[model samples]
Target: MAQPLQPAEPPKARAFEAIVDHIERQVLSGELNPGEHLPGERELVTAFQVSRSSVREAMRVLESNGMIASRPGDPRGAVILAPTSGPLQKVISRLAQASASSLADLLIYRMTLESSANSLAATRRTEADLLQLEKAMARMRAARAQGQEAFSKADLDFHDVVANASGHALLRISAEAVRDSIEQLIAASIEQSPDDHALMQRTIDHHDQVFQAIRDQDAHLAEHLARSSLFEYYGHLLAKDEQIALSALASFGSNTR
Candidate 1:
């Protein structure tokens, strides 16, 4: 006769995760800083009361998050990294592509993020921020004669400056990720336009108006112009329902501002 079946065991938390959590707390609390080396593996094993393998696993996690780096054949521990949005942006763009997110979805998200960023920049931007914006605008103007690709890059740079001026790190990172992910779409839109010259001029004029509004510290006008510019450029690509929704947003911006 067979013995009674055993119950399935519940999954246990990995020992490495505890080490990861401890080190993450240290970094968050300012105990660890960029360019500083982590304690050696032996020290981490002793401190976390875990095996060497667990300590190694913890290091791997931190490295993947761009929080630390290690050199091969070096006895020194992993170096703490200055935080950057690069890893976050890569992950977001990858997920969007993997999930087959649509161009319309990307545009809608951009419109929302940029409009908010413009509004925030109107109030929070410093003189240096305004200088950056003007520099980007100047670059765009200079790039116009260089062709569509150059103009597009400068155009993106301008948006990046505006996003950075919003005084919100999350907004800046998200906007940059979304914009980078849609480079092909933007290029296609330019290539497919009936009149490339007209399109380029419209883009420059829109940026000029939005920048002026931001410089003037007119939050409502800045937001309205930002949203309107996006709608004007990408509205035709959107579904009828989306166009209707965005139109309502533009109307709201006009009345509210």
Candidate 2:
């Protein structure tokens, strides 16, 4: 019988991608700890048996992903960075501002994440967590006279605490990413409000109410408040269709509230 020829494998676009995968796997597997330096380019090139250009390209990709930081004039190559939501926030903001439908999608995601996070925060928050939330509230109250910028920072601090108290790391991470994206998207617009002080006060009051609900362990109320208050703050910026899509979330647990 004649020998059969097997099908050829697909071609890779570049050798650098393989290098990228190797470095990412090391980081992910904990073999490469945060703050550790990656092997110098010459070392990487020799180990991977690829050109220095390929190694450099892989470093570029990793740096852009927020996985590592490259210091100029440093012989240490790239340094590993602890994982963070910064990249997620950037991507989310980009997509949310792309179109009306995309904005609606992001809003929907925020609603779902916040509602679940608030509910869990209500059920699972510890005294220390509550103290953090109170600290955030105090900052917001103090920042009220300062300006929207300060108040906004304090506002984010409050939700970050709520997200942490959820006791779900993934939820907390995603919620923080989504919250950052949403805040960045609307911050300039919010600053343009005719009644800036009223808007700021309302924000503080709504957060206060949500905090009380969580303190009481009223999961339903906390969830409802999170969804409803978010909608109230940003719903007007959305089109009518988008509003209709999000209104259900705001009202979903109203009976319990």
Candidate 3:
């Protein structure tokens, strides 16, 4: 009689994942730092005892996470960066183009962040910070009167200035990173929709409220105002989305005739 065969166990990971793990260990061990150039592909292959294709695949993983930047022109072609939210933002932007996410989702995240920033600013804002905020707001008002190009630039400047004024480096960097990623989308949406006027008015009003709260040293009021403004924007977006869907349905009916 023949002996029975034993069942095979599942593998720990796929081949690419194994390569990814090996590189990740190096990163965690302090072997990599921002602006530090990675070894060339052939060198990496030898160092890891892996094939060149595996090395390439591992590089792709790091690049996708904003852990490394490939600068082919530089003598040091593959420089590492401290990981940032940039990779997540880039992926989100691409997905948003396919309607995998909505503008509302982005707005929601901003609402959560900016409301906290408002509270912090109420307690922490210095005279210099207030001056910066006032200057940015003035620029926005002037740009709004001029046209879209100026308006967009000023809009970015105002938000960036406000974020910086909160005295939180991490918060400012995160907000700016997301803003950089989706700025084109934001401009497009504002231009295409009648919601532009509504948005601008709300922005102006909330900005004034936030500024006043900070000047008064009222953290609670600032947070409340920020949350209220976000909710109002959310409602406007919801109504606009419904109207768009209805219009599309009517158009489809007409086309079928």
Q: Whose lDDT is greatest here?
A: 2
Per-residue alpha-carbon lDDT of model 2 for 145-237, expressed as tens digits? 999889888998898899889988788778888877877776676536798899888898899999999999999999999889888878888
Residue pairs with backbone atoms closer than 3 Å in model 3 (clashes): none
Off by over 4 Å in 2: 1-8, 97-100, 183-191
The Cα local distance difference test for each model comes to 0.83, 0.87, 0.68
Report lDDT (Cα) of residue 50, candidate 2.
Answer: 94
TM values, all candidates:
0.79, 0.87, 0.65
Q: List the residue pairs that clash in candidate 2.
A: none
**Model 1 stretches with alpha carbons more than 4 Å out:** 1-12, 73-75, 90-102, 184-191, 194-197
| Model 1 steric clash pairs | none
Compose the digit string of candidate 1's lDDT tens values, residues 1-257: 99988769956679998788888899989999889998899888888888999998999998998899998877989999987767866775676666543666777777788889999999999999999999999999899899889998999899889988998878887787777776645556544778777788889999998899899999998888877887777777767887888777765668654
Q: Quick one: RMSD of model 2?
A: 4.6
Candidate 3 local lDDT, 127-197, one digit each (tens): 99899888877886776667666776887776667677788867766666555555656664543446666
